[model samples]
Target: MASQKPRILQDTRDMSWSLIPLVLLCLIIAGVASQCSFSPGGPSAGPVPTFDIDAGLEYDAKELGFPIRHPEAPEGWQANSGSRSIITGEEGGDSSTVGFITPAGRYVRFTQSDAGEAELVRFVAGESRTATDTREIDGRDWVVYGEEDAEPLWVADFGDVRILIGGSGDEAELTTFATAVGEAQPLEP
Candidate 1:
């Protein structure tokens, strides 16, 4: 056993060797980072799904036991989706919903339910929102809820059924869809 160098010096050399793996890891990470690119907006959305409002309304009308109206697709607008959902809370019932993509690429969702106006508003715009104003669309009074926000909800009572329309479009675009839906004849269930 030749006299070994001081334990501290021997340990220092071992420590330096131990750092090699960490250095390599750092270099690998740097290389990966250099090759990585970021998109601030993230991935783009795919095309909207095609939905047939006629068949859906027929089914919903029979199943939901309520009147379901199908608005004629406005120019450059299309029905992208439709579904049936149960309205929860005190006014528990089924609802039929149809989503349209406007000409400007904005979305408007139309929901028809037998639920009361308050429950419909609560379901559509949340409990925190309240009736802000009223908009007359095609001689029909559409109660505006949460109008101060970017997307406001418009609810109209059509006798036994209540219709709620809300979306990302501006007033004009929303009004256009509302008018179409309001003026359209109810589909025979």
Candidate 2:
């Protein structure tokens, strides 16, 4: 005679139906917790409203949502336009917000999006890509890209600080530029 107890596979198959409900319950709890913890406007995650600085570019930090900390602008680079502003994406895609400045009389914008940064580098170098690097800043991951014929360089501006340097160029020059730009403020949730 067969055993009266249900087989393990059969029992698991039967219990599978309840898993959906459990997942839903967890999702609901997460949603509610996020709503309670996030900003009143919605799930906001960047910059505190109370942060203020004399030379700081002011914008809706909630919208930019990139973590930066105590940022300082690069030397000889002044805010040209679009500082601390959200640059909307084409049509209805992901938007990138950045602080814009003119370096060496050239328009350069800084954002938190690595894709956008790569695009910008490609545009400047007139190529698709050659190499890339994973960098850590304030314990967060950032990327560096290089082209085949051009000197290796990458740029990222956290908050107001602008960083642009050749990856393989004079190390002293890169250090100078980095130091001149200074460290940026960490983005807050």
Candidate 3:
């Protein structure tokens, strides 16, 4: 028992010594993290999170409940985030929402849903809508709705689903997004 006690204590001392380098590495990492350099900016300009478009599509495409297409933006435009969204107060109100950033850095989004045009427009805009004008692109008709004081909205309907694209973007940005959506294909990574 006496010999066993010394052996155990020696083992513990050896293990403690072996952990010294690991502890130092952890301290170095923490110090490096604390000293990280960032540009001068307020919280209003915090880093935006990037989302996996392919993964989000894989998840939302399975539960869209209606046949709809997802768009692939041209270069310089980026898909920001996407997920499956469920709208309450309506039966079978499952929807898919995808946010994007325009080439000029404006934020935009498209909500694909089985809801009616009014419901979808209200959901995307979250305010009263003003139908401005009609624009035809690639043989499809889209109605423009928005306010000068708020983000503009573009609403279009496929045969089975309603698409409401709205964002803090102008008619040109929205038009570009709508064109991509209209020419969308099956999701691919």
Which runs in model 2 stand beyond 4 Å of their true positions?
Answer: 1-60, 68-70, 83-108, 114-127, 132-144, 148-182, 187-189
Could you give candidate 1's per-residue lDDT for residues 23-117 as a string of tens digits?
A: 98988898788964466989776787788888899888777778888887679888899888777878767888999888788998899999888
Whole-model lDDT, candidate 1?
Answer: 0.83
Task: Compose the digit string of candidate 3's lDDT tens values, residues 8-92.
Answer: 3577678889899999898888778896444577345555668777677776767566765767776777777886766654533
Please report, in order, the local distance difference test score of every candidate based on alpha carbons: 0.83, 0.45, 0.75
Q: Specify the highest-TM-score model's number.
A: 1
Per-residue alpha-carbon lDDT of candidate 2 for residues 29-107, written as tens digits (9 for 90 to 100): 9898885344567764443222233334333344443433334655654433333422232311122333333333433
Ranking by lDDT: 1, 3, 2
Q: Could you give the C-alpha RMSD of every candidate to the true structure, in order shown?
A: 5.7, 17.6, 10.1
Model 1 CA RMSD to the hidden true structure, in angstroms: 5.7
Q: Between which residue pairs do clashes occur in model 3? A: none
